[model samples]
Structures are given as C-alpha cells and as structure tokens.
Target: MPTQHKNIVLLIADDLGKYMGSYGCPSISTPNLDRLADSGTRFDMAFASTASCSGSRSTIYTGLHTHENGQYGLNWARSHFQTFQYVDSAPKLFNQAGYRSGIIGKVHVGTEEVYCWQVREESGTRDVAWVADRCEAFFQQATVDDKPFFLTVGYIDPHRDISTRGGFGNQERQYGTRVPLLDVKPEDVEIPRWLTDLPETRQELVEYYKAINRTDTGVGLVYEALERQGLLDSTLVMFTSDNGPPFVNSKTTLYDAGIHLPLIVRQPGAKAGIVNPNMISFVDILPTLLDWASIPLDARSSDKDSRLPTSPPRQGRSFLPILQRTDLLPESDWQHHVFGSHTFHEMQNYWPTRILRTRRYKYHRNVAWRLDFPFAGDLYASITFEGIRNVEPPVMMGQRKLKDYIFRPPEELYDLDADPDEVSNLAGEEACESLLLNCRERVTEWQKQTKDLWLYRDGQSVTMLGRYAKDGLQVPERLDFDVENPGTKGVEMTKHLGVDAYSAGIER
Candidate 1:
C-alpha cells in the first residue's frame, strides 16, 4: 500500500505529570486520555530535559537541550529567555515540509521569528472546549489548503493560578462557555507517593484533578473534531505534559516526579493499545515527527538547492521505528538513561540542577547546593505549604526534610529499585561511591558536549576554565575537568593563562 502523509496534533498539558488514569492514578478521572491510551502506545519512561515550562517546550520544539537552545528560563518573565535565532523550531521545520503548523494556546517558548507558526492563539483560558474549537478551525484551514497540518494545543490545565488561594483555576469561562466541572472529593484523591497525605494536600489535589478532567474533555473535543473532519485516521496524535504538577519538589525539580512525563502517541497505520517501557526524551519529539511524516530533516536545504541550512545536529534519535513495530525492542536497543539540566524556572528561582536517570538508579548534581533552594512563587503560597509551615518542627513532605530539601548536598544518588520514592540519599555512602562517580562523569561529559553553563562549582564553570587552559596551553584537544572533585586535579595552565587572556562571551 502507498504511504499516506500523516497530520500531527500535539496536546500539551501544563504542570501535569504521570497522574492520569491512563498511567494508573487510581483516583483521578481521565476518561478521554485513558481511551486515547487504549487506542495508542503509552510510553512508561518519557522525560523532559528540563522541568521548567519554556525550557521543556523549547527542548520539545528544537530537539536540543535548554543550554543549547538558549531558552534557559521562563519566556513570560523578565528573564525573557528565548531560543537562539539560528535554531530551527518544530513549526519552522514542519512548515518547510508543506505542513500548515498552528499552536492554539500558551505559545510560551519564545519570539515569533523562531516559532513562526501560521496560526497562533495565545489565550490563557482553561476552557478545553474553546481551545478545541480553535483546533477545529485550524484543521478546517488545513483541509481547505490541501496540506497536512501540524498543530500544538497547549492547555493551561492542572496548573495553579495567580490566586493566593491554591486552585487550578478551572472555573474561568472562555468564549461565554465553560465545560461542566467535575466535583473531585478530597477523600477520594489518591495522593502521589512524593506528597504528604495531609488535608490541604488532598484539597489541592481535588482542584488539580478537576482541571485534569476538564483537560480530558478538551482532548475529547479535539478527537471528535478530527473524526468529524475525517482526519482521525490520517493524524498522528500525541498527548503529553510540559512538566510535573506545580508544587514543591515537583514542578521545578529534576526528580522523577518532575521530569517523568506522560507520553501517548497514536499514529496512523500503526499497532494500537501497546505499552512501551522504552526511555524517551522531549528532544526526540521533533525527529519523531519528521520521521513519521516521511519528511527529511534536511528536506528544505536539499529540495530548494539553496544554502538554507538544516538545523544543527539533533541530540535526539527518532523513536518512530518502535512506534510502528508491534513488539517491544530489547532494553539494550532502547535508550536506557536520560539526562536533565535545569538552570531556572521563574526569575528568582536560581537553583541549578543536573540529573542522570537510568532504570535502576538516579543521580542529581546540585550546582547551587549551598544556597537555600528558592521556590517558585506559586508553590511557596500553596495551601499544602501552608499546612506544612504551621506545624511545629515543620513536617517533612515525602521523607524530605524542609531544611534538607532546601539545603541539598552537592550530589545525590538514589537506588530507584529499592526506593522508588527517591527518599534515600546514597551519594555520600561508601558502597555507592563507584556508581556516583560514574554518574557524575557521564553527566559532566554531557554538559561539556552541550556547552552547558551550569557545569559550575564555586561560581566557576570547570568546563569553561578547562577550555581556557587548553587554549592557553596550546593543547591539541580540550582537557577534562574533574567536576566531582573540582580543583583537586586538572590541566594546570592557570599560571600561564591569565584572566585577561580569556574573552567575555566565549563560553556560550
């Protein structure tokens, strides 16, 4: 049979983690997502490179880490971080391949030049039906133009609003209509293992779950619209979240609760209802979309015969092969580990962290371990935190001391097999020394390769300093700095290379 060009619809939920009914969150109602999962492949170990909204979305769009993409912090904040002008975003790539790309809501990644979407609706409403209506219009336009379309519908559901009182803000009306909200009882809420089982926590979860249900309705509306337009079978639909829920130790952190996202991909002419346990990163989304559409990454440069360059080398490999296959590939063939780099979320939240996670273990290198980890504005004022702060001695949330959580060590290692909740710290333990060293080395290597600025200790980037040493020493290759034990051992060219020798803006 001849291949058919597939339309793409990507649905991204803000501040949602693996808390859906499809992912077996026993209490939260997500019938639409559950049904979609039943008809598609569900990825068990999908992770975002960063837990911050813009950074994670930029990674998804460009298939490059936050460090490489230059969107290190929130786009909406004063930080005004955006993707590099040289970077090729997902919409630009898809547009090059004759796809009419549109983003419905929360286009939070960067400047318009980088994204360059044909249609953009930047509404902040939590109304799923309203957003779905916009999706329907985009699909209709695609049909009229006779072009396969790529649409990203970003939902602001399940994220705490600006209200001082903790709530998901699901009650806000859009287009003079509101989807009937679900009444989620606090008693019925199944609190995640990472959060404390307090009354305030449960009450907050009730609001979160209600917002999720509303998001589910929005998903259903989009699906129905596709079906009505006879594009359901021709569209490759994906549902995922930007990061984990907006709370302490989840939204802005590098732990599993933060980076581990829910991924469901339903491709046309592929096997359905399969659960794949392969580890996939947000960076893989671009390459996967291109592969699925049978569009080459360098299609524009090759076809136009113009010097228009292709995107810089992608960091992620396409998983479309596994998506099409019926049987799950061996663990060896699949990506076994994922890396994360988080520099900032809001303007004030400057706790930089790097993480490496495998099936059995996870390691975190907290760059600013000495400083008290600053909280995202919403989390600090949360009802859950309200409960925690009022208690004497300050109740710990999920085996994490309020003090310990804030004043973390330089390194943290957890045996995920034994302690899935990631409560135990094995970094300083003698028994786990080798594993910690290996993880540190791997993460540092990645940082160097990506030219990560967060590879810092004592406010100095070891990677940058090593580069300066190699340049001054006139070495053939760059020298590796001992990130684990900084200043202990490395190419000692500082005596020969003065601070004046290094130029500003050389470390990007």
Candidate 2:
C-alpha cells in the first residue's frame, strides 16, 4: 500500500532552552541539531505555553493551557497532577488517523488512559545513545508494517541529574560502551545573561553541555535510522524542548528564557533551511500535527454525550500555512502576540502568572502578589543558587533583587524593544499607561475566553461573576473593573445584549 500521509518524529529535549549552536550560542556543541536546523525551518520565536515540565508537555499534547487541562504541576514525587480524562491528547488524535503513535523516555505528562501511546518505553537514564537505539528498533518495526508512525522521542538530557552533585548523568557505561564525541570545557561555557558567571555555574554548565551533546548524537542516530528505513523524506521531523534549563530565573518563571523554546520543524515537502521568526505557542503543536495528517480539528474532541461543560476547546490554530510559504512573511503577517500561563511547577510553587507578549511589549499579571514566590526543588538545590546565596549582603539573581523576585507587584510591563532582558518595569510609568492598559485588557479577555481560575482578585472572581445573573440583570458582555484597583471604574458594560456600550461608572 502507498503511504497516504507523512510520518511524524518529534524529538523533545528535557529542560533545554535556546542555547545551542543553531541559536547562535558558540560555546555549546550541537552538531546534529544544527544539521537538522539547516535541513528544516528553525523557529526563532517558538514558546512553550507553560514553563514547568508536566504543564508544558500537557499543553503540547492537549493544546490547552494548564488551567484547563488539569495537569497543573509536576507528575512525579507525590505531585501527581493528571490531565482531565475527557481531554484529548496527541497520541489519541494520531491514532484516530490510523497512525501508530508511540513515545520513548520521559513520560511526565500523565495517566495511561489520557496519553494512550501504542508503544511506550519509559526510560530513567539520561543516555541519549541508548534512547536512539530503542527508537531505531521502533522505526524498523514501523517500516515493516508500512505504517505512518507518530513517534515522540523524549530525551532526558540537559536536565539536572537526580542529585545536587552537579552531574548531568552522561556516563557512557550506563547507556552502553559508546563514548560521547562532543565534550564542553568549563572555561568555554557561555553564561546566559540571566545567570551570574561563577565557577560553580561554569562547571555545572559544562555537564549540561555534555548532556546536550549526547542528545545531539541521539538525534543523529534517529535521523540515520529514518534514512535507513527509507522514511526520511516522508517524515515531519520536529526537535524542541519541554522548557528552559534548570536554573534560577529561567525554569519555573514566565520570563523569556523559561518559555522561549528551540523549535525546528522539517515538514515533508516544504522549503528547508529557513529561519522563521513567527511567534508560535506550544498549544499550536497538536493542531499543526492534525493538519499535517489531514485530520479534522473536531476529531480531537470527545463525543457530544461525554464532553465536559467546563472543558474549554483547543485555543491554537495550525501554522502549517506559514511552513508552506516560499517567501518570508513580515512580523505583522504572522501572529502578533502570544499568551502564557504558569500556575505551579512543584506542588508548593504556586505562583500563578499570566502574560501577554507582543512584538514590543510584555505584560505579566501575578495573581498572588502578596505571597513569597516558591522555588522548584531542583532550582533551590542547584549549585548556581548556592553561589548566589553565598555572596555577602545578598546579591540579586540576574537583574532582579531577592525581595523583588519573591514579592512582585500585581502587574509588570516591559518594553521588549528597549529592554530585551526584561529588566525595566514600565507598568507604573505614565508614558506607557495606555499600552499597559491595552495589554492588560487583552490578557483579561484571553483569560475569560479560556475560563482561567486565576482571573480573581481580592476573593472575587470577576470572570465567574460576569457569567452568572445578578439582580435579574443580564450578564455583562464584558467585565470592566480595574484589576489593579478592583474598586475603581475602568469600563462599564451595558445590560442590553449585543450592545457595545461603556460607562465610566463603578457598579460595586
């Protein structure tokens, strides 16, 4: 039988940010990833919807935010937050299209029924070579059956090891007798702008780089496997990470370093070796895959009888059209803005943040501004944090003060064009008031659309209130109360349905 659709091989790296040779980081060695980027379209502005492990992966699988999907925190260590049973996942979608969907290594997303992979090989070791070997076997089997496979190879590389001993677990003998070709020296480590350059940081970075190099080698092996099985041209190969590195100011935070991922997609018959700068979210991944497989969007949802009323529909559109474009589109021609939400990383790290990022501005609405921000388990025990805490008089992490990082304002706005590092807060500035308000409104509208639970302030959920009947009055089309000052009037909506009326009167 002739192949009807292209196969999908998604290689996901754990805790890896955009710090590779293809992304213009010279110190790190990622030859396989660079080659893949050269043979595909490298997305410069791809971002994860959430920064935590299970939350980010859940977004990729279900095309819904953490708030809607219910995988709000880590999946292991007694923090077993599983996705809602009614939610449709990626493997289930691909399976419906008659493809054998399988996953190898690092299954953090959730329950067996929700993920439903046809072939599941969960690995605890961080050995990329071993993972590549297993993937090769899977590719060979798929070749035998002539099945269009949707294989997701999750590499546990580049993430911190099980201990605070600063090892990335790249031991060669643990996987096999194979030796790693790429090795990074401590002195050659290029420190990220958000991290302080110290001996411990450099040393740990070396291990991280080694793990990344191992992952790259694994990628090369998988590519070769596909080639050997005559599936290279018929495969849509995508390589990306779950979130940013395991470090302070990156992993669990909604900062650019945390959510900004490295995405390279080599579509079956599209133009290759192009750098696409379009802003895409992780939520778009499932839809894009469905589109590529010629599956209907409605195919992902549950049957009409079993659908949950509170479960919001998928909020992402496919970017497959952008991939087919021969000429580069302008920034305005693509998605102008992307939204992000992070409710928790670990069970205790409950700092719910919502962000709306445009080309020039970023607005972060911290829901729990009064509480001290908690840290992830790995980040708190990291050697980098040790170095930062050892300094006298308490030095700040990156450009943020210790207290400021813990106790943040309710809102934060940054001009990305002027302050790319997000060091300046323009939320309170008089000149940026209108822009801030507009961004805030956009975020609030998005929250309402997604039915976010964090849209509440001061023990009152404006979103929830807007949905119910009040004093026999029809529900307002929009909630116009100021988020910063809950009692103040911002924009008032009329009681008449379909009338876009606004009044400067406070109802409360």
Candidate 3:
C-alpha cells in the first residue's frame, strides 16, 4: 500500500439506527459495533438528511442533501431516484487522486458516472462472511497495485426481506467462525417507545435481533480481515447506518427515531471511546473523508459539462477538527441545529416534509399534510404494524393514536426537552406562535439553499410558481388559499423560497 496516504473503509448497515448496547439500548446485541465505539469516537448527535435508503446514502456520498443531489426517493425496484450526474462524489474524488476505490456490497446510489469508483461489486447477498472474503481480496489487490485503498462495505442484514413476511430474513442458517447465532428470546427484546409491545411485534423482534447479531459478526469479521492484512494502523474506519430501523414511525418519518442514526469513526491514532456531542448531518461524511485523504476540500471531482452552469459545492464542512474531542464543541465552532428533508421512501410514500431540530425544540413542516401519510411497502406489511391495526378498541400507536399517525397537521412543533417523542404538538397554540414562526423560517431557508421543489405555498410548489412569477403570476404567501373567499385580492405575494435562480428552472 502507498505509504503517504491512509486507506479508508466505510461500513454502512441497511435500515439500522442506534439499537445496539453501546447506544444505550440493551434490547439488541451489537457487540462488534460496541467494540468499535469503545475503540473510536462515537457521535451522539449524528443525523441522516433523508430517512429513505437511497436518499440517505446519496447524502453521505455526495456531501449534499437529497433535494440538492436529485435522489428524492428509493432507487431500487420500480422507483428510479438517482443522484444528479454533475454532483461531486467522495469515491470519484478519491479515484481522481489515484486511490484504489471500490464498493464491495450494496450500491444504492445510481448513474455510474457520478459515483465512478475504480472497482464496483454491487450485490444484495446477506452472507457477510462472503463479504469479508471479498474485502480481503480487495485489500490484496490494492497492495499489488501499490495504492492506498478506499472501500465502502454495505451490509444488508437487519433489513426486511423482499417478501413482506420474511421475518427480517432470520432463519436456521449457518454462519462461519466468530459469527454466533444469538439466543435472544422474544421477551428479551425491549419494544421502542415508538412501537406497540404486542405478541406479534415481540415475535418479529426475535428474528430482528438474530439479523442484528449477524450484522455485528460481519463487522467483526471485516475488522479481523483488515487486521490480518496489516492495515489497521493505516486505515480510517467509519461505521453508520443508511437510515433508522425498518418499522413504522421510524423508517420514513423525519422524527428523531428515523433520522438520528449511529455514527462511529476510528481515525488512525485517534483517542478511543470518546463520545462526541457535536451535531452533524450525513452531508458532512464526504468532506470528512476528503479531508482525511488530504485532498483539497473544494477540489472539483470532475470537469464534465453540467446541466447547471456550475456544480454546487458540498453543503457541509469536515468534522475532522473535532473528531477526537470528548467535550461538546462550542456553537461558534460547530452547528447546534440539524435539518432533515424527506421527500419519499417508496414511490407511493410521498409525504414531503422538512424538519429543523435544535437542542430545545423540533419543528416539522408537512407540505402534503392532507394526504393520509402513505406507507413504505415493508412498513405497511410489518408484523408490528399489523398488530397495531388489528387489535381491539382504543387503537393507538405507542402514546400516539393510530388516526393521529395517519393524518397530520400542516405544521408540528414540539419542545424536545418536554416531549422527545414529539407526541404533543404546540404549532397551533397562541403562546408558542413566535417560536413556531422562527422554526418555519429556518426550515424554509434550508429548502431554498437546497433548491427544494417541495416548498409549497397556496397548495402549489414555489419552484413551479417561480417560472411564472416574473410574468406577474402571484404566489400567495400562505400554505393554502382560503376556499371561502377564493380570491388573491389584498393577499401578500412573495418569492421567498424559489427566487432568481429558480425562476428559469434548475438548469441554471
């Protein structure tokens, strides 16, 4: 391997959040990941921009939000969301700098030209030992090629099977050495506050834990492989999930349960077991990787002609400066608030929403609040959801009622210190109106920067309205037009969200 540059290894799990013992949840066994947390720095305030798989992964790879990158929904099977071709990608940057870049497991982001790695082995197999074997081969190839390596290993365990009732893919299967099938009983699992603790749910959890144990073993196996190759000291390892757990109210929602994920980084020679409290979004991952590789932070990944006059620079800065800090970084040095943008999960799940979260408050803006929040195929078919819907009278989902979950208001505001689960809404209250408006403005500002087309006013997209705004088309400065009056007379019109650049479409 090249002596001047350190290797990079990114391990991402599918449909996982902070469910491990290390993240203070003892319900599931994640010993391998726990050890990684103990040996590296664990970020407690890490987040995903979008809770959907492809959208979140694209955010990590491109250092851009889903709206900015154009991966608005799922990219697999009937859904066709892909990152924009003009975007700068981490793998392409590493490849440009002469590193041996490869992705051994699942590759969710699309358009080969955007994520142009030197080697790509995209697969959906859950046999993690096979994945370890492939990683070992890639390391050896890098050694032969005499270059530092950059590899992304995506684990498919702990995610639901394509078959709706596959029970998280847990079965009487054989796993190789160091991979023990955990004996976690249904009673041993702790039902999250976001879920109902029922018999069917418990039964399904037993299988979910088994899958989690396999994923943990896979992490250990890959670490052992890197150690065997004598690259432990020369590699930068990071482990995180693409999204939260594959359950209702978690997978597709902008609530903390869905977007707040586990992020552990073990940079070479960094202090071990340090807990980092600085807030970070998934968009920062790419810049941090490039920072570690000693590449120019603003270096263009490619010079190909773009649809836009110029490709947008990454929205986030690197966390390398504070990666090893145990204390909370000051607000001036790091951002205290985190933002989330979720457009869709499956094509059918089109409840476009934006969220702004600070330490004290959380605000959610549901653009299509009238739509009875659609479900991802897996979540709708899950045993947990089935139990929630089929049970006797007084149907409720955790502390929230089932109807409340299905039908939501246009805006929701919660005091996080009082309601971490975001059950109580204050958006409609008179006293909280000031805080509500402030949060709404902040989220709208974020949408404009990302060029989000979901910014709706008067029941229409602001981006669409911008195309005709210069021609004196009025975009009423309100969520929806008043049906009783049915006129724009004396109403304020503004191009607050989509202005100037958006007037002629995103082509500019």
Ranking by TM-score: 3, 2, 1
Query: Which lDDT tens digits does candidate 2 get at residues 1-508?
Result: 6564479999899999998899989888888899999888898888898899889999998989998788988888788788977678888778877898899998998888889999999987676667878888998888778788999988888888866557788653455555364557788899898888888899888888888888888888889888887788889998999999889889999989899899999986677788887788999998888888888865654442343433457899888878755454676676668999999888899888999987778899888777898988788888888988887766777776666777788889998888877878898899989988798788877876776766753444554455343434343333333457554234354332211111101121
- For model 1 the local lDDT of residue 199 reads 88
Q: Which candidate would rank higher by lDDT, 1 or 2?
A: 1
* Error at 208, model 3, angstroms: 0.7
Tens-digit per-residue lDDT, 1-508, candidate 1: 3234489999999998988988989688889899999899999989999998999999998888888788888998578888877678888888887788899988898889888898989988887788988899888878877888999999888778767478788655432344778877889888777777788998888888888888888999999999998898899999999999888878899989999999999987777898988788998898898898888854432233233333456778888888745454677787688889898888898888889999889999888787899888899989998887666786687667778778888888999999987879998899988998899888877776666766653456654555456554322222233557554335333221222212322433
| Candidate 2 backbone collisions, by pair | none
In angstroms, the error of model 3 at 404 is 0.9
Error of 3 at 350 (Å): 0.9
Candidate 3 per-residue C-alpha lDDT over 403-500 given as tens digits, one digit per residue, 9 for 90 to 100: 88899999999998999888999998999999998999888878777667887788877865676666878777888656886688898875574454
- Say which candidate scores most in TM-score: 3
Report the error of model 1 at residue 368, Å: 1.4
- After TM-score superposition, the amount by which residue 302's alpha carbon in candidate 2 deviates from its true location, in angstroms, is 5.3
Instruction: Pull out the clashing pairs in model 3.
Output: none
Better of 2 and 3 by lDDT: 3
Worst 10 residues of 3 by lDDT: 497-506
Which regions in candidate 2 have their CA more than 4 angstroms from the true location?
Answer: 1-4, 171-181, 301-311, 324-333, 464-468, 471-508
